[model samples]
Target: MGDDLNNDEGQLPRRDLLKSAGVALLAGAAASAGAAAAQTSASAPAPAPAARSGKAVGARLQGVQHFGLTVQNMDRAFEFYTEVLGGNEVMRDGDFRGEKIHNTLLTDQEIVARERGVNPRTIGVPDLKDGGQRLDVRFVQFDNVVIELLQYRDAQQPMGSGDSWAEPRDHMSPAYPRSMHICFYIRDDVDFNTFIRDLEAESARRGMTQVKANRVITVTSEQERQAAPLDANTNRITEGKSNGWSLIYCKGPEGEQLEFVQALGPVKKTFEDAMAARRRMLAAAGG
Candidate 1:
């Protein structure tokens, strides 16, 4: 799935991974509390509630429950997210002996076979010695956002770059539309420049690959909207003003593109909206 984890489907991925002995402190505690409640309730027989006229189960989607990305190195990925990036480790699950990836869920059989080993069951063997592919996953929380970082273990093939699959080093390839990235909002209290400088310093000290200490830019549409044409036709052009301090981008472990963004200043948003905002930010930040 490249760094994208590429499971753009609405359903959350099944967490069949074996859990680590020391799961994330906070989320673990929360889960344990919930488990304790369930156990206590189990001891006493409680009557099943009658169905109501209210909305059905899992109906009313709140929005963006969580997203995940596949990583090659577990420790490095954890370090960058929890330590360097300053997010809390929610929980860790790992050392799974079996994982199920079916053609029914994902259309690409080739990706399934390569990323996840062949399903021995499909071959008529219910139990195989190899135990299919192994997986280790951890969840990280950034306030409202939750992210799952999973590593595919015991696989013969490499993940290669999912985003770059269509074109070398290309972040966006229509071939893999499921390919995605996550961004973090910089707190208003923090100085954007200082945060960026520290990130650059840390990246350099750690010798991070695919780091872009550039492309940090500011954007504002305060003045009349300006257009930059890709060709002669205005349809192909990117429109917006690159002014007011805005956002920056960088790559995290597993080649996942992460971002730090400042709240947009008052300006008329162009049709491109967030896309135009990003362009203005990058150009203003001067990468």
Candidate 2:
């Protein structure tokens, strides 16, 4: 989640004595690519057409690099993401701690409170004992994005304390402030209902019993009809009147909220047109 360590070095072994050698590699290649794109956009000629069309002018970012989730168990989370969801395991690291890590993670609240002559507990800041806050992380890559699974260990809350929820809570509702959910865009060729049904069955077989897929909701063009429930195994869509989009909500192993969305009919066409316009804009900008 920290950006400061984009190029952290790791040790590699030799073929013979197993001597460790430092190798340079990207810790967050996607973030680095986004930064490069932002730099290029910032250097473009003043008042480009894209900027002129907007009211506010500033640096433009490419898009999201990854989503980070704190999980109760690293191994279980990895299995669900990679085995069940078909994500590729790209990287894994553990025991991330130290002063640099603390500062980068913004967990050095106690140090700041001490310097400012304030009680750390008064501000609800966890005491950073021994500066030994650590995190075990695994990166899983899917077709379009990556999800970073993290298990944190610190003096305030040790590892295996079971802080990550195993069940949903009231505050976790999407209506609550700061609540968020991960949404996956379904492929055009895939049947939305069939995908959800198969996903639920496979996830259960993989030991993610906590993962539950909700009923399919058809968001139609009719203003009076909203969230019409449809069978998860049946297709009940009308192309003209009731084909705006279809979606479903679910929960992951750690009670993380998840969503699957597929745009249909006019909505799909609008999305395609917007994508085409984006390509033309990028071409005109010499990107």
Candidate 3:
């Protein structure tokens, strides 16, 4: 995150590349959306139910346990997530395959059997007991959130025969449907621009190709925030005038999208303040 990095004009700057890539990606997504819209209904669908029931059912639910990802290599993913990003290694397991796995994962035994020309019960299991499914897994934690990384012996178009594991897909784009990226919070004490420059250097040293915006962006005006092409919920979190937010998007070791955000004011505080206000209201109501 250095100002001097931008001054170097000998070659194309990383930020320029990032901006180009972002523009291309957004343009492609827009074109794809336009083509899709021509074939579909214009109106948006109704919002999904927030809970299964009105009161008691919703109250029983807790927060998310973890987010799961099927990765190509477990060790590589572990290194990128924990070593590079400073996540805590929580738990790990290996060679997850069995009849119980089939049931728990809801494997389509018949379909797998037909595709492989094998018995439904013995698809992945060589001894003909359970489908011979196998996978390696690890869990990494960032504060309260846990990310479960898995390397599954692919169910379809598997790379290896018998005991060997299959290779995962080679490429993914943020514009692709179902593609996702995770954002990490930068402490308020850290200078966002400097942190980004350092992050770029460190990641490059570790053989990652950075795709970051040229500069840290902060919304300075309410009109700019309102004009942002974002949904309402996201706007509240990232685009408000009092938020004092700056962010940059980049890529992980395997080209997976990643984001870093620094907030000078009021993002988390908004939530904390609301909770405090609720407590006061409840106290006043004698509840």
Candidate 4:
């Protein structure tokens, strides 16, 4: 839902940056997944006399319904998303039809960020060439997912992105891959340490160490829950060990790493498919 802030990266609203350091709000990295083997063609009725390898590939995908983020400040991300993550305001665009949808999404982000290695001289930005000037694109919603909050205020802004802890980043680094986070689940009778003491009282009322959270993470494997990708569910776990889901992580005011989830029981079952286990580890690493 945050799709790591719907594909987080940050900036173009200038100065003060930091939206990277692994996970930008993702509760148990959004619920510990175990769900697989459910749809036998929607109810075990139609596929009885099936045609073998002729059709039925897959892509009726229904999960992860929203994600997108580009923030550097749209009024401090609309006051930290409608006052500390309540999030709702499902609309708010800007001029030039938001720069023609921000240059048609920077032409699909210069072709899907060039296979995750990204180019354009390590994002030196320049109106991203022909597309970039939304300056303020909003769209928020929490529960069923949906997030889009860009700023790109006249481009040019990306270089070590401020919030300096010097060098810390860790959702295993490599600059957080899976299109970025948003896992906010927390509802199985709340009170996960009083939600990190109200996220350290909102990072001490925004003296802002990027609003805090980070501690609870417990996977307990099936190849580390199919190691995320193919629209990551971040390996759902919690069927035991006093139940599952449990997670914590926070940071927004630009350091942007969020997640605050809790399940504590019930949610299990997996036959381990996860996109054929990530295509058998990308065909045994021959990729």
Tell me which residue pairs clash in candidate 2: none
Model 1: residues >4 Å from true position, as ranges?
1-59, 99-132, 155-176, 216-245, 264-287
What TM-score does each of the candidates earn?
0.50, 0.62, 0.55, 0.28
Q: Which candidate is the best by TM-score?
A: 2
In TM-score terms, candidate 1 sits at 0.50
Cα lDDT of candidate 1 equals 0.46
How well is each residue in 27-104 modelled by candidate 1, as lDDT tens digits? 434444565467567794432355222435532222355688767666667666765665677888754443343233
Tell me the RMSD of model 1 versus the true structure.
15.3
lDDT of 1 at 25: 25
- Candidate 2 TM-score over all chains jointly: 0.62
lDDT of 4: 0.46
Better TM-score candidate (2, 4): 2
Q: How many Å off is the CA of 18 in candidate 2?
A: 40
Task: Please give, for residues 171-235, the per-residue lDDT of candidate 4 as tens digits.
Answer: 43225566356666554443456545554455456555566444334346534433423223223
Q: Candidate 1's error at 98, in angstroms?
A: 3.0
lDDT against the true structure, per candidate, is: 0.46, 0.57, 0.52, 0.46
| Candidate with maximal lDDT | 2
Model 3 agreement with the true structure over 1-287: per-residue lDDT tens digits: 11223313222133222232234334434544554464456575432476334435533334357788766555566666765566668888766567666555645655677888986545433221253546667888765467887665644423322223434345666777888887766554544555555555555656555333333235566455334432221212346655666666776655567777654456556644654564454334322
